[model samples]
Target: MIDPTGRPPAEATGPRRAARPERLEGLVVGLVANPKKNAEQFLDAVGDLLAAEHGIADVVRTRKTSITDPIPPATLDELAQRCDVVLIGVGDCGSCSAAAVADGIAFEAAGVPAAVICTDAFRVSADAMARLQGSPGYAYVTTAHPVAPLDEAGVRERARQALSDVLELLVQAPVPVAAR
Candidate 1:
């Protein structure tokens, strides 16, 4: 079978995750927004929290042209060049969830630590995508589902609740499965 994700023959390997930063202070962050409903707002809220809580120096934000497709290589390259880390999000549906996970893996392959956020409803799809992409235990954050219907305050609340997990995914090294 042809592996479209470009995984090596080894089944246990995927994109090598970037090294975690010792501190969040002064580091540039990238936010890759999927064009799904309320995705930009959700990302904005998360960016605000990261800036407020972690002292991130700046955020370089970009919106993908399509929610169901992988991020364009040029955009991914730009983010990798300009940002220390990246957060991709608001994957509320199946296709977007898979795309987000793929984008996160691509960022990691570019040597940027990435945190991918999805709604709880799409967790199965996100996890499956990770495995398909050769990252069986890739870490991603999930918020409560149905983000499209949430008002600004509601979305921010979800962001607030997901903030800690976001921070952990960005700054902390993932423990090996064997260690867990």
Candidate 2:
């Protein structure tokens, strides 16, 4: 069953007994970069990291039209149908970051695994994660931040860590068989 966080309960049995495996074979990784200059750079680095470090199968990158509104319906659908997981980077702006997090939640509801990367200074990553976790529209929310000054390596590392954490949680959590 779907939880308030919008994730299905853990699956039953075998190596995947506790949580789903990091099943990236044929999985598409969606990158949602905020329309800030640094955002694209960060996302590109993240895409490279996923491809190089984790060997993700495919990467699809898109940007939100505006920071305040939800991602466009077409974009959401594209990601949902083609992607196994999505990563969103919220630049330095808090409002924009929150909106992106909300958008990620919506994407999760559409059945794409999603995570958000916040600015390290804001410390809102955890709060955003909690908000998504408590909401009915998103079930598996995870957060990370690149150390400021925004270097490629930092962005890539943070992205890798956040994606890794989300996959681990998915693999570890008990899939709820019935609605809670």
Candidate 3:
């Protein structure tokens, strides 16, 4: 399909995909946490689950400055260099949720398997952002809404319930650009 500007389709910009590892076992995982309330707590629980259940060797965690903004290129580059697969999380609102999915796409573009976590309420927003960003059907994990007000036990329980889904998505091999 031709675009309006008479360009055949804007070619995806950036380095070609990095090599995807065969598995997550003993791999270094990157966690890009959005700076919304309890975002780190939510991701930390998920990270714990990844370590305990999936045998993820180590996690390099970074917090984005704000959810409404794009993830810093340096952080992505660093995670790309230091980690194998990544999990970007706590997209409980519209903007942050979209950012998480976009970040996931960026990780995949760089050949790292990634999954974005959000509340069920923001699932549609995350999926829509993925589509708008040229990668429709990007997989993500969702938990209950109102995560910010939740106590530790509440978030932990939500994390536990959602951990399996996050594990499944993070373990998958990166989809080749052609398939996307």
Candidate 4:
């Protein structure tokens, strides 16, 4: 279950912490687009919705060259420092969703609150959330399922919902201090 880095699959659960009030001023949304052609379009729509609905302060976007690979480590580290919370969308690829969740957890480990939105059509947003809750890497994971295939309208709604859930969780979860 553990990857080479000693991180386990995201489905493994850990002890819950007491909820804490969110101290973030504004949210930073991280969008991970699948390599598919429509990935960028979907991410843009999601970003626009987060801005309009959730008052997100900034949006950071990254695209993977392939579903099998992880996003660049530099990109993940940059996002962790710049954003209090990160939103990763898989663009309807379950395989990519798994990879993206791993990347999001890396962000969390570095002190950023992160949630991964599973874009797989077979799994509902709620299901994704459940899976993430159990995942070791994404102990703080959240999910958003679009009404249908990702389009401008669907992406907007889904992104808004996903961002809202992530913000709520981040506000409640205790902030982990950086190790000395």
Write candidate 4's Cα lDDT for 1-180 as tens digits. 223223344545642333333644466666767676455665577567667765778887777777646667788777767766665655355555556655655665667665555644624332443345464323434434433455666655555566555555556755568642
How far is 15's C-alpha from truth in model 1 (Å)?
6.9
lDDT agreement of model 3 with the native: 0.78
User: Which candidate has the highest TM-score of all?
Assistant: 1
Residue 62 deviation, candidate 3, in Å? Answer: 0.3
lDDT of each: 0.86, 0.59, 0.78, 0.56
Judging by lDDT against the true structure, name the best candidate: 1
Clashes of 3: 0
Q: Identify the superior model by lDDT, candidate 1 or candidate 4.
A: 1
Stronger candidate by lDDT (2 vs 3): 3
Better of 1 and 4 by TM-score: 1
RMSD to native, candidate 2:
8.6
Relative to the true structure, candidate 3 reaches a TM of 0.82
**Candidate 2 local Cα displacement, residue 143, angstroms:** 7.9
The per-residue C-alpha lDDT of model 2 at residue 122 equals 42
lDDT of 2 at 163: 60
Greater TM-score among 2 and 4 belongs to 2
Each model's backbone clash number: 0, 11, 0, 8
Prediction 1 global C-alpha lDDT: 0.86
Estimate candidate 2's alpha-carbon lDDT, on a 0 to 1 scale.
Answer: 0.59
TM-score between candidate 4 and the true structure: 0.63
Worst 10-residue lDDT window, candidate 4: 1-10
